[model samples]
Target: MERCNHGTIMRVYRTRQLWGSGDDTFGRLFWSFGPSIHAFSRTVRPLILIDGTHLRGKYKGILLAATTLDGDGGLFPLAFAVVENENFDSWLWFILLLRQRVMPVDKNNNEFTISSDRMKGLLRAVAEALPGSYHSYYIRHLNANLLKTFKSQKLCKLFSRAAYALRESDHKEAMELIKAKNEKAEKWISEIPKENWANVHFKGARWNVLTTNAAECFNNVLKGARELPTAALVDHTRWKVQDFFHFRRKAEATWKTHLTHRAEKWLDRSCSFGSKFLPRTCSWNEYEVLSSTHTDSADLEKKTCTCGLFQTMGLPCGHAIAAMGLNKLDRYKYCQDWFLASTYRSTYEEVIHPTLDRTQWPEPSYDLLVLLPP
Candidate 1:
C-alpha cells in the first residue's frame, strides 16, 4: 500500500504468546493515506478530533480515529488505527504514531488542538505523547455526565451556556447562574480546568468546534463497515475517503463565492450586524465602533477588535466590519485563507488512488510473514 501511495504510512505490530511458541499475532495496525496527510498539512485547520469506537468483527477490537474539519466545515478523517482495546497503551501508541507520522510540529513551532470525549486514558495519553498540543474536552460528553450525575435539565442547559460562551464575562455570568441554582453542580464543573471545556479560556484556535462530533459523525458513516474483518474494514475506509475527496473536488468548482458557503454566511451576518454600528476614525487603521449599548476599538492593520471574535475566529467581527466599511476596505481580504475556495480546492487537489483487484496484485519483493490474529 505504501509503495503505491507515495507518502502513505502503514505499520503492523506483532506479538507472541506467553510461551513464545507460535506464529506472531497481530497486536495493532495503523495506517494514514498520502493524500489525506498532504491535504491536512496544507489546508485543513490544525484542530483534530480523536475518538474510539468498538468494532464488532469476529475478533473484537477498537477503531481509533483522528478527524478534522474542512474549509466548508465538513468532517475530514485524517488517520486511524485498530487496537486490541481502548486503554492507555493503545491510546498512547496510536497518538505517538499520529504525532510522529501524521502531524509533527514543524520548524515554525506551530501548535494544534485535539478534542475528545473523556475517554479512558486518552487525556493522559495526549499529555504524554503530545505534551505541547492543547487538549479540549467535548462539551456534549461533559454535559451528558452532568445530566447523569445530577439529573437536572436546567443545570445541563446552564453548563452548555458556560461552555459555549465567547467572552470571559459571559462565561463567569453563566457559571454564577449555575452556582446560584446548584452549588454542587458548580463544584463538579470547577473540578475540570476551564481551558479544556470553556471556549473563552482555550489557549488554541478550536475554530468554534467544542465537541468530538466530527469524529463521531465519521464513525456513524462507517457503522456498517465496523462489522467487517480487519483488512476489509481498512479497505472500506479507503474507498469512503476516496469518495469524499472526489465528491468535494468536483463540488468546489460549482461554488460561486470566494470563501466557502459557511464562511460567507458568517461574514454576511457580521456585515448585517456591523451596519448598525457607526465607526469613528482614530487613525489610519484604527477606529472606534459605537453602537447603542457600547463601543469597541477595531485595529484594521492588526486584524483585531476589542470584541475578541475577530482574532479568535479568523473572521472579522461586527466592529471590525464596521471599521472596514468606514475605510472602504475589502472585507474578504481580512478572512483567513483556510476558509477560501482556493484553499478548499487545494485540499482535494490530489486523488486517492484505488487499490487493484486481488487477482492482479503484484508479488512481494521481500519475504512475507504469515501472521495470525490475536
Candidate 2:
C-alpha cells in the first residue's frame, strides 16, 4: 500500500496463539492516506469528528474513522482503522496512532477539539491519549438520550436550544426554560459537563459543528464497501477519497471569490443584516453597533463581537461586519484563513496516485508469515 500510494501510513498488529502450530493472527489494522493527512495538516480545521461503524464482512469487526471539515464545509476523512471491537484498549490504540501518524503536536503546541458520542470507552480513550485537547459530545446523541429518559419532545428541543446557544445569557435562558418545564430534566443536563455539549462553555472552536454528522456522512458513503474484505475495504476507501479530492479540486478552480461558496454566502447574509445597524466609533478598532433591538460591541483588532458569533463560527458576525464597514476595512481580511480559497486549493493540490495491479507487485525480502483472522 505504501509503495502504491506514496507516504501512506499503515500498521497491522498480530496476536500470538497459545497452542496448535502457533501462528500470529490478525488483531487490528490502521491506515491514513498521504493526501488526506497532508490536506488536513495544511488546510482543514483542527476539530475532528470520530465514529465507529460495524463491519459485516466474513471476519466481522468495527470500522473506526476520523474525519474533519474542509475549508468549504465539505467532509474530509483523515484516518481509518478496523478493530475487533469497540473497547478502551482498541480506542486508545487508534487515537494514539492518530496522534503519532496523523496529527502530532508540533513545536507550536497545536491542539484539536474531538467530537463524538458519549461512549464510555471513547471518552476514556480521548482523555488518556489527548489530555490537552478539548473533547465535545454530539448534541444529537445527548438529545436522543434526553428524549429516551424524559419521553418529551419539548424537553429535547429545549436541550438542543441550550446546546446550540452561542451566548452565555442565551444558554442560561434556555436552561431556565427547561428548569421551569421539568426540574428533573434540567438536573439531568446539569450533570454532564457543560464543556462537553454546550457551545458557550466549550474552550475550543468547533466551527459551529455540533455532531458527528461528517463522520456519519462518510460512513454512509462507504455503506456498500463495508461488506468487502479487508484489503478490498481499504482499496475502496482509497478510490472514494481520490474521487473526492479530484471533484473538489475541479470545483474550486471555478470559484471566483477569495472565500469558499459557503463562506461567501454566510458573509453576504451578515453584510446584508449589518447594513441595517448603525456603527458608533469608540476607537480606531472598536465600535458600538446599535439596532432597534440591542447594542453590540465589535472590535476589529480582536476580530471579536459581543454577539459571540464572530469567534465561535470563525466568521464575521453582523455587528463585526457593520464595524468593518464603518472603518472601510476589508471584511474578508477579518475571516479566518481556513475559509480562504487559497487554503482550499492547497488542500486538494496533491494528486492521489492509483495503485498498480497486485500480480505485478514485487516480493518482500523478509519471509512471509502465515496469518489467520482473529
Candidate 3:
C-alpha cells in the first residue's frame, strides 16, 4: 500500500495495534477509495449498504464494505476495508472514517440511511457513530434468524408480510396473523424496532430493497482479489471499480427516457396494472381506486397512495397510476429526480485515473512498516 500511495493522491488510511514485549501487531485495518468513487458518492442515492465478508487468502480477515445505490437500482461502490475482524470497534472505525472522509455530514443530522443484515456489533456502532442516520435491517436476514428457532414456513411467510407490508394497517394485519399462529414469533420480532425492518415505518426511500444484497454483490466482485497480497489487492479492486464506472457510464449514454431503465420499467408496469382499475374522482387530486378486494386512496397532489408503494418507491403505484389516468395527468411528472438517467450518468462521469508506474513514484515522507498477519 505504501508503494502504491507514493505515486497517487488517492488516500489509503490504516490503523494497527502494537503488541507488548515484541516487534509485533495484533490487528490492522486498511481502507481506501479512488477519485471516481469520491465523485460517484456525490451523485448516488443517500442510502448506504454495509457488510463484511471473510477473506480466503493465506492471511484470513474480514473485508468490510460500504456501498451506495445507483439511480438504476444498481450497486455503486463507495469504499472498502480489509479489517482484522467485524468487531464493534472495527465497524466504528470504518463508519467514522466513512463519515469523515467520504460523507462529511453532521453526526446528529439525518441525511443518510444505512441498510445492513444486522450484524452483532454493527447496530451499536451505527448508533454511536451515526446517531442521526436511519439504520434498517434486511428483512430476509431477520426471517432467517427466526427460522433457526421456529421452522414453520407459515410463520416465516407471515413475518415476511409484516416486513414487506407498505400500509400500517396491512402490516398490523400480518403481525396479528403471526401472533395467532405462534406468539413466540410475534414476541421475537417485537424485540426489533419496527423502523429497522418493517417497511411501514421506514423513514426514507428503500427503493424496494429488502436486503443488504448490494454489499454482497460487491463482495462477489472482489472474490478473487480477497486472496491477493495487501498492495496487489488494493490495486486489483481499484482497476475493477474503474472498469465498472467506465462501462456503466458509456452504456447508459444511449438511454432515451428521462428516468432510468428500471424506473421506466416500473412505471410502465404500474401503468399496465392501472388499466385494470377505473378510478372514481372525489376531487381534483383525490380519487378512490377500487379493486376486487380492497380500495386505496390516491392523492395526486400529495404524490402519495394509501397502498404506500408510491411514497415508498418514489414511483407511481397502480392506484396512483389509475387515479392519474382518470384525471388525465401525465404519469412521467410523478417520477422522482432520484431515478433519472441524468442522475445515473452523473454518478459515473468522473474517471479513476490509473496509478503511475513504481519507478515514477515519489519518496514517502515517513517510513511505514509492512504489516504481517498476526
Candidate 4:
C-alpha cells in the first residue's frame, strides 16, 4: 500500500488517496489519553479542572476531563471518560476517576482543586462523594448568559455592577436599580435557574457561589470537534491538546515559580484567617449574578471589577477581590503545586501504590507463564 501524508496525520489505509479512497469508513477506537493519570500527576498536582464536552460517537454524550490548572500555560488533558451529557451520574463518574487517580498518593484533599462549569447535579454529587476543594465556575460562561439576558449596553452595565459588587447592601441596590430601569429584568430573581444561581450572592444574601468558565472552555474545545466522527474527533483533539501541553510542560520552572510566589503571597494574607471566612465544607448560598453598573475603577484589588477573570480561575483568583475581603484572601485561590507550577508538582508520598479495587484479585506465583522448547 502506497500513501502520502494526510497533512499532519498519516494515513492508516489507502487505495486511491492517502486520507481516504473517497471513503468515510474508519477504524473503531476507544479514546485513550497520553500518560496515565499517575504518570501525568508527576507533571502537576492538587487542583484539577473538569468539564464534559459533547460526543459524536454511537454513544452520544460528553467527554469529561480532569486537567492541571493552566496558570503556567500547562493545560494537559489528564484523565477523561465518556459521559452521558452533563448530569449527576456523569459528574459522579468523573469525580470517582479523579479520586482514584489522586487519593492513594495525596492523602489530604489539598491535592485536588476542581474548576468546572456550573452544573448543579454534578456539584451536588461532588459534594456528597468527594467533598473536597472544587472551584467556582468561571465567569466567561456567565458572560455569555448575561449578554443574552441583558441585551442593551445600559442593562449589561447593571450585570457588571452586580457581578463585582461585594457589599451585601450594594448587591441589593444594584438589583433594585435594574428592577427600576427595566421592570421586566426583575424576572432575573425568579427566572435565573437556582442551580445556575449557586454561589452568586445578591445583596443581603449568603451562600457558596461561583461561575463555571472552565467547563465552558472544555465545551468550546469540543465544539470544534463535535461534528467530527469518532476516530478523527479523538485523534485531531489529542494532537492539539498534547501539543499545547508538551510546550507548556517543558517550561516547568517558569510556571512553578510564578504560581508559588503568588500562592505564598496570598497564603500570607490568609493567616489569622478565621474559619468563618474559610469554611472547611461548602454551605450553599444565594447571590444574584452581577447585573450591575459598569465602572472604570474595577481593579483586582477591589475584586468588584467588571471582569470576572480572577473569580473564574479561582486561584487566589483576582488580586482585587483578595483585597476587598481582607480575611478571605487565602480562601479564594486554588492551592496546588501545579497551579503554582512549582518545582515540586505534587506531594504524593512515594510508597507502594495500593489497588483498593476488589477487581485486583491475588494471583498465585506458580501461575506465572513459562516457556518450553518444543
Candidate 5:
C-alpha cells in the first residue's frame, strides 16, 4: 500500500484495532487507484456503482467496492474498502473519503449518480455523505425483494418491464398489467421509490446501468486474489488494473470508428429497429414515428422522442433513429461525448508507475493511527 503512493496512485491501506493500541483484531482498510482520480474526474461518466462481498479468508471482512463507467461502457474501479461489516459507519467512512479524494461535492448541483442494490446501511450513509447526489437502486435486487413478498416469475417479468420503461405512459402500462395479475404485486412494487428503479424518473445519467453488475464483474475478476493476504491481494489488484489500462490503451489505438464499440453496436441496433418503424415528417423538425403497436412523436431539434428513451439513454431510440434517417441526420450527433473512442482512449492515457521498495520509501511526516471499532 505504501509503495502504491509512489507517483500519485491514490491508494489507502491500513489495519486498525477495535480499541486504539489495545484490541488485537483489525477493523478496516481502504484502497484506491490514485491516477484514476484525475482520469475519471475528467474522462469517465459521473455514474458510480457500489457493492460489498464477504471475504472468505483467514481474516473475515467485507470487501466494499466503488466503480465507474468508462467511455466504452467498461468498468473503471475507483475505490475499495475492507471493513468489519457492511454497516452505516463503514459505508459512511468509505463514501466520505471517496467524495473528498475523488468524487467531490459539486457546489452547483450534484452531478454524480450512485447505483447500488440498496445494501444494508447504504441508503442512510449515502443520504448523509452525499445528499446532493442521486441514488438509484438495482432493479434485480428490488425484484428479488418483490419475489419475497409474492412468488411468481410472471410478476418478476412484469416488474422488469415496468422498471425498464422509458416513458411514464409505458411504465404505467406495465404496472397496470401487473395490477391486473394481482393488486398486491402492484402495491408492493409501488412501495419502492419510483426514481430508484424507474428509468423514466431517474434524476441523473444512469448510462443504461440499471444493476450493480459492473462492481460484481470486477469482484469476479478479483476472485483469485481474495484468498491472498491483505498485502498480496492489494498488490494483485494494482497489477491487474495497470495491465487493464495498458492493454486497452494499445488496443483502442487501432480502432476505426469515432464511437466506442459498444456505442456503435447500440446505434446499429437502434437503426435496425428504426427501419421497422414507419416515419412521417410532420414539419421542419418534427416527425411522427408509427409502429403497429405504438406511436411516438420525435423532435429532431430537441433531440427527444415521446417514448423518452432518446433523452434518457443518451442514444437515439428507434423512433428518433427513424426520424433522423428520414431527415438525413447523422445518428452519431445524438450520442453523448463519453461514447466517443477519443474519450475512451483518453481515460487510460495516463499510466500507473512503479513504486520504490519499502526500505527505500520516504518516512511519513506524521504517524497515523486508527481507533478501535466501536
Candidate 6:
C-alpha cells in the first residue's frame, strides 16, 4: 500500500486523516509515477508521443496516452488518461496532460511533436490549450479519407498528388505544386481554413507531419479489447500500450522512427481548407484514365468496362489498374468509392487474418459519385 499509494495508506491508517499534501492519493501516485516514467523515457530521448486506446475488458472506455521513443529502437510509455468517450472534452484532458509533460515551463522545448488526424474541432481545442506547439495530421488518415471521399479513380490520382505534397514538404505549397496537375481540388482552398495548411520551420524546412494515425493504430490494437470490462479493459490497455511500445521498439530496430510524425508541426492553422464531395465527369479524351473517348462505351465512363469488374464485381478490374497506370496513377485510390474504407480491407483481409477479418462484406461500388459527364 505504501508503494502503491506513495505512503498515503500509511499516513491515512495511522493519522486518521485524508492527506496533508495538496494532491490526493491518486494525484500523488500520478505525479510520482508520471514523472518517474517520463524521466526514464527522457533518458532514452525527449519525445512524448500520445494517443487514446480503447479498452477490451468488461469496462468500455477510451484510453488517452503519451509516449516517447528511444535511441535503441525501444519505446517508453509516458502518461495516460481514460475516458468514456472521444469528444472535445475527453480529448482535451488527454491533450492537457500531454502538454504539461512536454513543455513544463512553456519555453523553447523542441523535444516533442504532436500528431493526429486533420479533425477540425478537436485540433482547434488543442490549439487553444497550447499555443505555438507543433501539431500534425497522419498521412494515412488523409489517404484513407481522400480515397474514401473522392470515390472517382480519375480524381484519385490528382488528389493523391496533392496529398503527397502535403505529406512531403511544407503543406502550404500543396495547391502551388499540384493545382496545375489537378485543378479539381482548387475548391478545397475555399473550403478548408488557412491553418490546416500551415507549417512549422524545422531545421531549415518549413513543414508539418502530425496526425491521429498513432491513436488510430492504437485503436486497431484495441479491437478485441473494446468489449471487455473497465478494470480488465484498462489493465489490458496498459499491457497493450506496453506492447505497442514493444512492437514499436522492434519496428524502430528494423526502421528509423520518430516518436511522432511530421503532421503535428503547426500549432496554428486556418480553417481555409474544406471538404468537397462533387463528382467530376471529364470527357473520355480529357479523362486520361479511360482507355478510349467513347461515351457509348457504357463500361468506361461508368467506371467499368466489358470486364464488369470495378462497378459490378466490386474488386478492381485488372483492366482498370492497367488503364489507370497508363496515365500514371495509384490503383488503390479508386477503392474508396466502393462504399467505405472498411470494405477494401475486407477483400485483402478476408483471406489473411482470419481471426480478425470478416467475410460477406459489401461490394466497393454502391452509388455513383455523380450522374454523368454533365
Best-fitting candidate, scored by lDDT: 2
Candidates 5 and 6 compared by TM-score, better number: 5
Candidate 3 local lDDT, 196-273, one digit each (tens): 889988886676678767888898899888888766877888788778878888889889998999899999999888
Identify the runs in model 2 with alpha carbons over 4 angstroms from their true place. Answer: 17-23, 107-110
lDDT of 6 by residue, 35-82 (tens): 224333324333344565555555355566555433232334455455
Candidate 1 stretches with Cα past 4 Å from truth are: 16-23, 104-110
Which consecutive 10 residues in model 5 have the weakest lDDT in total? 9-18
For model 1, how many clashes? Answer: 0
Model 1 alpha-carbon miss at residue 37, Å = 0.3
TM-score of each: 0.95, 0.96, 0.87, 0.49, 0.87, 0.46
How do these models rank on lDDT, best leading?
2, 1, 5, 3, 4, 6
Q: Name the candidate, 4 or 6, with the larger lDDT value.
A: 4
Off by over 4 Å in 4: 1-47, 57-59, 102-113, 118-123, 132-135, 138-153, 165-173, 183-241, 249-374
Cα lDDT of model 5 by residue, 1-374, tens digit: 53554323343433433335544345666777766777767777788899988888787778888998887778898887777788888899888888877774443227888899988899999999889888989988898888887888899998989888887888899999999999988987888889888988887767668877799999998898777776677777788888888988988988999899888888889989999999999998899999988989988778788887787767788998998887698888878778888888888887776656678777888985554332
Q: lDDT per residue, candidate 1, 247-335, as tens digits? A: 99889889999999889999999999999999999999899999998788999888878777887788999999998887689999998
lDDT of all predictions:
0.88, 0.89, 0.78, 0.46, 0.81, 0.40
lDDT tens per residue, model 4, 1-374: 00111111112222222234444333212233433344344644445566666676554656665655343433445555654457675567557656654444545553345555566577686776676554444444555666687776666667556655554556667778878988777676446542233334422111122344444555676677776654456556565555554544444435524455445565455333321231221112111122134222223333332333334333432333333354343443434334453433331121112123335555555854332211
**Which 10 consecutive residues of model 6 have the lowest summed lDDT?**
267-276
Q: Which stretches of candidate 3 lie over 4 Å from their true place?
A: 1-27, 30-41, 104-108, 280-288, 365-374
Task: Extract clashing residue pairs from model 3.
Answer: none
> In model 6, which regions exceed 4 Å deviation?
1-36, 39-41, 44-50, 53-60, 72-76, 101-111, 152-177, 189-213, 240-374
Candidate that beats the other on TM-score, 3 or 6, i.e. the better one: 3
**C-alpha RMSD values across all candidates:** 2.0, 2.1, 3.3, 13.7, 3.2, 20.7
